[model samples]
Target: MVLRLNIDQIEPATRDWICKVQIVEIGRPRESLDKKCTFQNLILEDEQECQIRAVMYTDEIEQYVSTLKLFNTYLISTAKVKVSLTSYGKPIHRFYWILDKETVIEEIKPSDEVEKPLSPPNKLTITSFDRIPHLMVDSTAEIDVLAVVLHCGPQKTAGRSHHKCREITLCDNQQNQFLFTLWEDFGEIEGHEIYSKMATQRDLLVILGRSIGISTYQGLSLQTRYNSTVRVNPNYPQAVALLNWAKQNKTMLLSSPSDTTSTSSSITPMIVTPSGQQLLSIADISSAASMGVFCVNAEMAILDEFQDFCVLECSGCKQKKRTKDRKDFHCPKCNRKTSLVPRCSFQIDLIDNTATTTASISAELGEKLLSMTAEDIFDITCTKRQSLSLNPVHEMLSTKVFDIQLRKSSWTSSNTTTTTLSILSYMEKQHPPQSTTDRTSKKIKPLEISEVEVMPTTAAAAPSNAVGKLQPPTPTKKV
Candidate 1:
């Protein structure tokens, strides 16, 4: 036979020893000293919402913590209650619970008003992603849904701080993505392999509980709440279907509309020399400007040992000085030093990309380029040692061949004989642009440029010869 006792009516046992009792309320626990010790605050609604300091000792914690499911009724018989004072002038009850060897957990049940399942709730319906509801859900509400795994990995040191967190990105067909972050020790999971496996194969659906929430990283994530469950299987039919859909609509889903705009804006075409016959690549000008160099493509041939610094007339003051004073290399035209010396040292010439008719890269952009090698800039396989010795002509030559062969040139009039001589003089002055012998001596490493095999723009447009239909595995019980 089952016995039920009113929490408020229980009188203090004469022995003043721990007694067996049912726990009516398991209010949210309070964390103190950085969540080291959790203070379970409970209240006997029959008596009052009076604050109670229920301390779970470390050893006792191991037992009850696992059984402390949210919103589930539990029979915690072995517990000690004591009187404690609060910040206010009133006495409250404090329960110190410990599980002994003899303690046994009774049957766990959903809270009052248990709903009879029509079936096993096989058809799990997932509505739009919503915020985790404020109210607690009982174990009966457990359901499964097909969710795309966006990101998953073990916790790492966040920023410069010592705190660790695991970040996961998840998305669904609804065109919504959520970032899930598991904090502290909970962040360390099996490994990154789970994430890696899911990344290559989209349309993965894992069983999750309502305890999960949309994390700060804007991803759907789960916590170690008692009811949470997860599993992955390649054979699951639901998984197979979702995978097929994702593969079919991969291009439509992954392609961003703004990509076209950015691509077009970055490809700037301009003529750098007066001959105007040889069209200079806009990227070359951007690269030179970023390196603090001021010269046309024709003049670039003459540079040998690239200097670390350059002098430019300050666009603001029109005074020639080392371009280092202002953040954006501006000259102090309005200052008193402008007229006293007839030219202010503050006046710095802006390194403008005359080809694109734009200002030169700031000091920040130069620092970025310094960290990158010529190989990184030109997407070549030259060694680092070779990259350091690379001259402007070599940089131009490497890019010019591709431009000439692959793209159409916009020619201009004026093929002056002096232009050829000027170009030759510049090339001679530079470290005799890297010879074929030097390139051969450096041992060119095989380039690893992955060929981008573009897929059809739409599922319907896909070639009939396409290999297989994308399909996810069926949803099965999580192991």
Candidate 2:
């Protein structure tokens, strides 16, 4: 008998266990130091979502990794579990399962019972922007949101990794404006196609099964995950209703103040960190300016080495300082002789599967994460080494994972829209909190909704404890 172990239940100490999981995403194969490994993000569900990351070392499990298909369920056993090694890989769970030589893998036959729940959900039960506050913090609760496409940014590679992303600004009937970020292949073509029609006519965009979360800087934004689907101008009843509502509210959305007015104001400022410290992809930093400061757990080696990773900054305003006499320093922002602090103003480029972005760490925080003072890095860079050895900064940051506290700062005026990240604090160790389901299941007051937004009289009378199940998709006439 195959022992079905949930992804969340698998820990570093667990061994010789069986896990039935669907391969949700396959990362590009990476070759490092004469060894190749591929990372796969898997999902295990038993009436609830449980996600985890698994790695296949090339020497032991290369053949199995190549034959695995995305969205296909497999029963895997004899796998090794270890504390997650890399943070920049954007691990889905706190711990990662490793497939070694002894692992056994088999594909399960698809069946009616399995197919019904496993398929991508087609019907979208729309959630209003005002109800965003009710969304459980730091948890990936499936949500459907409908809005009119206002703007779509060009798609670009995010970090040093294989992640790609695009930005979309949307508005709803209630003059609620939101920022939806598309990662990887989600809405890649649809965003561009909608961009062309945005100026010509009103276009309704439906984001189904998108992960909704609140951030510290950009407030609430829609994030696309591996299972999320995006459709433009679909011929559904909800889409038609939203289209009409958008048409009625076009004038209000246009006249509203872009800088001050935001849909996030209706929601509270509390954003729980999912996977600890709201583990965000590199691509999320650009649109997270309004969400406030958040934390990301990333591997130390994910960043590239450069000289400017360490520099001098003014202690008063935390801005870069300019020196005329090498002793006296002047800050451009303060424009006064300020005491220049030798700090690490490291511009580290971080890459993950979703996207890539550069993060600038403060000297004090950089020293803590790297375990090396700015002066130590300066000495190593300034003085030539006779033998081959890694730089002091690289030696410390190259192979470790850290939970980094990042706050959004200014951005460069370049076309790429580079966002600056100020590191507040960092720790080399991470302790996984209770599972999301356990945390979210805790008692919280229900949100009050108006009559119009409530369900129909018949459905509203259904059992209070009933969980809504997805109905099979029906054929509908194209709009």
Candidate 3:
């Protein structure tokens, strides 16, 4: 008989010991940049409910990846134990195991005791939204949060690889709203479920983000890291409290002043994004304009080296499409047959003598200004995997002044409303300067070469193969 060990008892010094563990969660298989290595992690919990991470790689991945079932108790032995390089955003265990060919995995008999099945960790503590900022100060720290689902964004493919990504907003008891990104499997599976349910059961669901990774980049947002956990409507007690809190504050949670008004919204509050186009300076931008479009002259720069400038949007509802396969999918929100089309939507900053302001540019106007359609840009950036940031045409366009048509807009965050501007259209404030290559464009010939010669005659009889060719109506004679 072999000696058995608990997960917490296994260490590097332990030898020839078997551990009975139930697979709690299976992580997504990850591939190396070179494609030479592939690996996945299985979170295992022992009888004491202590957890550890076990990894399987390459050929071993092909052999047993499908054989293992979640929450199934198995006896694992002879796996290599190693110290964890980084502990943040992973299992609490200080060590992890690497399974190899010598490893033996056998299912435990049904009559024997199984530690637990489908049970979330008991130690998870929900952090209040107010403290999220404090956690951000330590990038290495992981956070657990419980919040109500407020809004869901359409799925978007990023980079040339088209890695799937989706964004959703959540609200907490403090009424703070924050954007969280669901990536990889979270985006493909859970994101769609949340979005579909949102149509009918909008305010009912509360989410628990366990071991979530935080980012301070554009703003504070939550994201999923490798082996991160996200549970929707989990049976946790906090889920109940958050759901009740959400229902009680449903009025405040779902209210949007921008939704009620068109063209412009009043200065009245909670992130005002006036739909009207206006401008002057980014810093001076405020609801005081309650105005129409305005112009500004500024040196422009494409802040991002490369990014998706457009997304597939439903023609009917105008919401972003979240499906991975865009060829054929229905928009559940509109409950109608709809097709996806490229929409012109991107942000850029313009700096004038006074201040620099970032603004949004829409389709028809942006296409005219850039001389490149949204569809073409999407193909180049996301399909062809090319960077437009350094293109000569874009560089030259940035050198010219812009007649920016601004629109007022507002965004609600942390329960506060602030006004912002968007661009309805933009064009060169002055005629574009002549290029050196166009020097001979306006030169005229010395001869009377401008006159055109007109040559026309009745066409010959059509060939047998030209059956569908028009006969020009035989030039019908007057009555």
Candidate 4:
């Protein structure tokens, strides 16, 4: 004969008792060594709510600890009962349960009983955000949910880091957002790529195996297990539904307030100009420089020169040990050897129209022209000349009118003191030959001299213009 008993009808008087009970709830064990207390709470419901606290010794806890997991239904027997006092001195009943080494745990198979009254969909469940619970389901279970993608990093290769995992910001229609991490190695869907694709397409759908709650900076978040399956496609029917839902609930997912503050607080690159006027192009420099442009300056001198390359002195100290030469300059400031060294320095090298001379200009005045491109250089020389009154020396350099600057010195009669200045303004003026005319006009063939042939003649000529020669007016007027 089979006997049925209600959970509430079970009496503590049944000594050395053996009773069968369905596990309505299962929880993780809590232990307190100072209080000499260790227990796990289980709830049973057989016509009424019955809560039982199962106590265990340290030895028994170690024996069956691995076999216990929350939410698994079990039939526990050989449990002892006792009365315990609450913090308020109220008496509470507790049970001391143990599973001997020889006792075997029999897995209870779920019944195929027909459903009775279904749970109301409107019932609200309270859960803690600090510790999210994991939901376990069989491999054959099917589920549907909505999720979001939060962060994505670069993809990696076999020998490199992998990029299959993506952190997601998920939410249900309940106005709640949770973080979900998806791993792609398993059959799980590609969440990051899907979210990116759907951002343009406007919707996504996902189906997965299990949901586990984990702690994150943003509180408790849900994650997908390896067995979870996700499907995201523009063609999915659920995606269409989600799009329609989003359209109706436009204000639900508002942008986080933190994002606006971050974007507004960003730093932009600093722009500095002497005239405080914005320059549009290289041609704009004529107007800009004429108004005194802003530029950084450094003191430098030519240390070495090669065929077409020259190195300038760099401002840095060098360490020195034993050296064969004892007369080298040493910088006591840096405690290193000090000497002019070859380094790249920005300076304008003037090239005349005749390709006859090139002179290096110092400071900001020099760097302005050197920084222009070949095309812009040609444009500046051909046009925009009047606006700048660009020193006559620079004009000749830009036009390639001649190839050399004259170096000259003068001695004062009273003290016989000598002063020297180098000027780049003198050179021959040779225009290209005019096109032949049909009438009696003579076509003069302009002489063309190569740079190599002009070097010796240029060197032999004595410095005539101690001060630079006056520059002629430009072909056009300033705008």
Candidate 5:
């Protein structure tokens, strides 16, 4: 039933392929043509290194995926061969296999006849957040980044296709912070472990591979590409160095014993109460020793006019919707006629009398602040021909002092450092501050590297000794 063929012998007309292959990498399943498609890149050995791209479109995609476990050899048969298309995301191989419902795959038994596995096409280099801006704009350069987990957002279904993603905060040694997004398969499964680790105050190290994505909404965010893996608290030197740095520099400023700890992570504001965490005035925030999350009591000075506040989002990809006809919205990405979802984007200026800064808040949080969804707000502002003045928002927040938690992140470009502050949380009622004696410093325990998940069967699996020498880790066991 298996017609074993060499990689060079296969042609586009080949209908069946029975070959021994070691699964190199598995791409997260992506939705296409209203159906989910899974892709896996495999390695085959000959006089020279060769690769094969395998795709599954059948309903048994999950079953097939489980069979082609990473690093495991398989005897795949009846797979239809085809010339790889440049539009199929980005492929590492020139030829691809289309496995429909009729294809057969079986685990290759361990024997001397089986050839040695070939290394995957990965150079595993750990990069810094500061260097991200200099990288080639549209190149498929696989780079790795290591950072500390700051905050993990609730899993939200996104895009016009309604795919799920969990947004998280990651910070580096330079105190630079960036947003990292975990897509659908990861959001549903591995993301819970990351959330738990943060809640428990566990020192978690995150390493992302081949993530090069830029967005206007979240500046300099990292996205997981095909075959990429997220490793938490990996047993590597960089992880240890980061842990030591975090433990030593958890607080941004070196404060007096009586002063409140200036934390880079989340800080519950202690305002209007005899409390634990000391509150910093808006002017005092910029002068603090380090860059991180800060808490302050500030009133809304001015709300920007609502001229382009609300935009139409495509129901399929969640991208901005455009149209020639006002009644019908079209998605440029999905190329489909889709329903429009209204969302808000606000740039509100806040002032505590001591200082002023502009904070950019996305539509979801804007909805909470205004107590109205973007759709509802749009109707009142545009549908009714109401003035673009943000009188309603101003009236709600003006003169009302709020205990606000702000995250201060900085990045350097062109030999200049630029700092930006974004609101994390705010409360109308002040909460008591925590006492320094009540706080417990977390200890970094030496991780058993063996407990880390099995590495991919590639050079990326090499031991990490120095910076940029990172290997993708297996999923952490749920705590």
Candidate 6:
């Protein structure tokens, strides 16, 4: 029998080495842009608990698709070991494996005759909730999370594709709260469960497996990817500790009402504005200047002339066209001719007795304020296409008192400082959120609010509308 080696000891020169490892993760089979090639990735771990990513091309993937199952131990040999070019490989080891047709794989079957092999390593990397803010700088590093579920927003449809999404507020031991989103099926299944639980249970413990951090303008947030898993109140020491912490701070966690957010692009991403949303005085907002997000009770102090009230955005990527005309007939960014969607683009002055700032409004809340969809409004403005017109929004909001959520960002240059505030959502005092929640749950209708304008999580000289991610998304997989 050949001696087995740990993942750390295997190198490019170790041609004769064999590894008795368990498959911890199995990435979906991905095809190239041209659909000319296909590949699947696997994360393998040995007895020492060291992990490394192993990839299989179309040929090898088909050969072992059934032979290699998750949690099954196998004897692997003759796979090439190469240095990883990315830091996102969940690494203490720098090398990744590539198994070709020549590589040997043998599933170690269970037997009564011999002693049982070591159990498969769970391969969980539980990241502290506080550390998530710092970890946002590395988008590719997927982290497991143990968080207390404070609130669950009603699952709603969003985006041009009308994807189903749900947002939940998660609290860590440090008392720091952040939003986590469940997309598509995860939202339908787990989101429905949590929303149902909130009716009875005050706090719920959730264990997330392999969640990606989205450092949006809303600060550090989390979302489920295609490979991510959601486990509710699993039996574990870390989760038990988190449960104890949640029980201690139930009131504080649920004090401030929020709608929550989705995507990595939005910050102050709280979309849930309580129906009875209480407005805070401008004086009250100024005192909590250190906070990244603020929901103030303010009125339309001023409304700017609606110059570009609506901009045409690429339906595929949801980015505005950069052409000089700003309304190019077709999207240049997409590989093919993609459709354009009309989104609300305007600004209004929000004011209280103590302070004031210009808050930009786009899509989401802008629709509610105007009482019209962006598309319908866009068509009306396009006939004769007036450049600047009397802003109609002022008249509607001038007399109305609304609860507005704003994200504050500042920049300093040439010894001069400028601050920008953008409105995230608005709430009518008479209209309660629970009523809206019940309607959407039965209808499952989606809302489209693609464009997000806010600064990074950290304070910097960057403009208010500019959003920064740890790394630009990879053009190919978008994984």
lDDT of 3 by residue, 1-479 (tens): 56788988889988889987777667657765468999887778787888777888988888886678776778899789999866455456789999888999887656656642334444445677656644554656777788888777678653223367777777776655556788867888878888888877746578877668876321346777666667677655667777888888788777732122122221111111112224455334432333223445455544543444666766554556544234756667557676776664555555555455455554444444445666776677666766554476456755576555444433333443334445533444456434312211221211111123312111111001101111101122222
Question: Which structure is stronger by lDDT: 2 or 3?
Answer: 3
Candidate numbers sorted by TM-score from highest down: 6, 3, 5, 2, 1, 4
TM-score of each: 0.29, 0.35, 0.48, 0.24, 0.42, 0.51
Best model number under TM-score = 6
Preferred candidate (lDDT higher): 1 or 5: 5
Q: RMSD (Cα, Å) of candidate 2?
A: 23.7
Residue range 397-474, candidate 6, lDDT tens digits: 545666676655544444433444566556545542331111111211111121333233332111123322111112
Candidate 4 lDDT at 416 equals 31
Two-way TM-score contest, 2 vs 5, winner: 5
Clashing pairs in 6: 157-446, 217-267, 218-267, 218-268, 258-272, 259-271, 259-272, 260-272, 275-433, 280-297
Residues 189-254, candidate 2, lDDT per residue (tens digit)?
655666666657653354333333332222345666543446576555666787777667666655
**Per-residue lDDT tens digits of candidate 5, residues 238-355?**
6667877876765651131112211212211111111223578866775553554456766653333533456665556655544312365555766877677566555555566565
Please provide, for model 4 over 47-97, each residue's C-alpha lDDT reduced to its tens digit, 9 standing for 90 to 100: 233444344455666776765543334444434544433432211234333
RMSD in Å for all candidates:
24.4, 23.7, 19.7, 28.7, 18.2, 13.0
Residue 259, candidate 6: alpha-carbon lDDT: 30
Model 1: lDDT equals 0.31
